[model samples]
Target: MPTLLTVDIGGTNCRFARFSIEKGALTLAGTARRQTADIPDTQALMDACAEALIAPGEADALVIGMAGPIAGQRRARLTNAPLELDLSDAETRYGVGACLLVNDFLAEACACLTPIGAGAFPVLGPRDAATGDGTIGIIGAGTGLGTASLVRDSRGAWLPLPAEGGHAAFPFTGKEEADFQAFAASALGLSYLRGDDVLTGRGLCLLHAFLTGERREAAEVAAQGLSRETETLRWYARFYGRACRDWALSTLCTGGLFITGGIARRNPLVMRCASFRESFYDSPQRSLLERLPVRRYADEASGLWGSAWLAARLIGALPA
Candidate 1:
């Protein structure tokens, strides 16, 4: 069985997992997590996590999936954190023969292949007939909004496509919501409100403050929940549903739409709220959305598993 190391780097913490094939199935051998702030550099980040999971030079390849746009698939600077990676020295520095760098959401897309399956993640919608052979959409909200897709080709292989759709303009409906959007834009000192600021933790804080006038952290607002009682989470759910609907429309995701992120996992009430369901199915093209499946990968380590999946295939991509 080929062995490799896979990493999932986020704005706060980095997750490392070692993978091996057992009876033709990819298996996670060991895993570890380290804070980005604690690791001194990229080398240290790799060394510490690798040491935690495996012995030196035991890996055949290395794969990294993190929060950043990859340039030439060899280098990147994380958008939400101070970490930067240069994979040119990966073979010599990490003692791995094959290496790859990719967007975190791409890794999420990879996870859709083997890691997600029957009862693997929660189906947030009423129906789930996802055979996962069509174009799949993946989106999430954490330190920032993340979006990606796994499009199935005529050859029936799912290819991960990265996108920065999170930075695009956020939609606000009605005069009340539009006023809040203006307020958010003004508060953040931006000309237009973007999804990065609308559907995340900061968005929760801003929404709470606008309604209650008593500013509190996102954690506080989340504790109130998205039930009929809590206005903050209801509005947040509305914004979130809009994001899902728009993404589904754009991608025309017939396979399935998977949601991954801390916000929903930490506050599942938002996903269960009536407002969320209403807004999600409120579009003119609601029939298209109704046919699509919606699921949630609640495990935070999904990216790590996804990275391992890619690392397993890295050997085939290496030059003969």
Candidate 2:
């Protein structure tokens, strides 16, 4: 059994965990999280990664899920962080022979493949309701809207499908949606809503403002909850729900809607209040969207777990 170092680099936080394969079971050694902006360069990030790995090994390799698109086998265009890193640079700095770099959202979806109990993860329907297929859809709202699809092969192992679904233009369906888009176009110079624009935490604030004319940060509105109700927060909930519903329908997520990311977790008030089901089932033909199971991952560390799993798969220790 060999130990692997797994890293998940987000715009806000970078988390690393060590896992070792012991008699066919992957065991967690330890995990650590550090801020991304605090590190100046790739070298500093590698140093942080080195410190995060706990077990004693010769440092076989590293697998990282970065926040931006990865070009070829190396190089990443990070969305939030200023630094763009090459995989070869990371391998040289960490003294590892190989490295795997994947988009952050895809990594999160891979992480969710592990069988987490119903208690650890909130379920929207029966466990048997997941369609018994290897297919899964993931949605995350952080600095941006993140999405990825997962397909399990005959071996029941998860494989991440690369997608730029977030960059897709948002489709406006209702009168309110048209009105909201008009406001955004005049205010933000956006011709049309992007999936990232309305699905993110800041997007919530944007929705709140469009609905109420009062502009406030997403954090403040979430912190205030319904204590200080304004027309804005109410609209924010509705818009957010509708956006989620649309995404679910577009993805046809039979496995489940695994909602991770900072914004989705913190804005419980909005999720509960929003007409999520109504908007979700509002499709013209509703056989799929009406029955889609939506669930939220309360634990934010699932990405790191997925990164570890990715490392094992890349190393040939675990089946893909």
Candidate 3:
């Protein structure tokens, strides 16, 4: 059996896990988490985490799922974070045979292709039994909006496709949405506000201020749990559902739509709101979307799990 090191790095925190592969099965051995701010740079963070989590040279390979766009093949940089990853540096620093870096949402999408446990729950349309055969779509809202898809290759293996769909222009549904867009444009000092401008954690704060003329942190607004914030939450859900539907339609993700990230996972009520489903099954695309299964990626460790799976495949412990 070979052991692999898996890392899921986000804006606020980073999660590390060790997985042991035996007989084509991956098992979680140990896990640790640390705050991202506690480290100075990517190398320092990885070094500290690796030292704390695993015995030197114990890991056969390493896979890192990081927030933001991944640049370069052998060397990658996270768009929103101040870290750069070079595979050669990582292999030497971590004492691993090989290392791979990928977009965090791509890892989440990979998780969707695996067998989900009880952590996942239905938040929208009925669960479809045939979800295993087709494409899967994923969108998450946290520090930013993340989007990705999983499509089966000719060999019937699911491959993750990562994209920067979050930067796409925010769609406007009506006059109210247009008005809100105007407000976002002026407030953010931009001619165009992308999906991240209105679908992320900071976006929620912007929404609260725009609707109530009272600025409040996203966490504070969520904690208030007041009726005044219901409309804002609904708006968020609506936009979220709209984005999911668009992705579903674009990718023909009949397998399902999985919503992950801090906002959706921490605040499940927003996803359960009627507005969310309404926007998801909105008229024109209702026929297509209604048949697709939808589930929230409730497990916080999904990215880590996904990374482990990728590592197992890379090591030939699992069929590709």
Compute each candidate's TM-score over C-alphas: 0.93, 0.87, 0.93
Minimal lDDT window, size 10, model 3 = 221-230
Model 2, runs deviating above 4 Å? 54-58, 115-120, 123-131, 153-157, 226-234
lDDT by residue for model 1 (28-133), tens? 7888888877765677866776567874257887888978899988898888878888877777776767889999999987787765644446545546475557
Candidate 1, lDDT over the whole model: 0.80
The lDDT values for all models are: 0.80, 0.69, 0.78
| lDDT (tens digit, per residue) of candidate 3 on 185-242 | 8988999888888888777887878778888888887665323347787887788878
Q: RMSD, each candidate, Å?
A: 2.5, 2.9, 2.1
Choose 1 or 2, whichever is better by lDDT.
Answer: 1
- Candidate 3: segments with Cα more than 4 A from true spot: 115-118, 128-130, 225-229
- lDDT string, candidate 2, 187-303, tens digits: 767777787776666666667677666789877766764334556556665555666666666666777767778876766554555454455556685676556666777777777
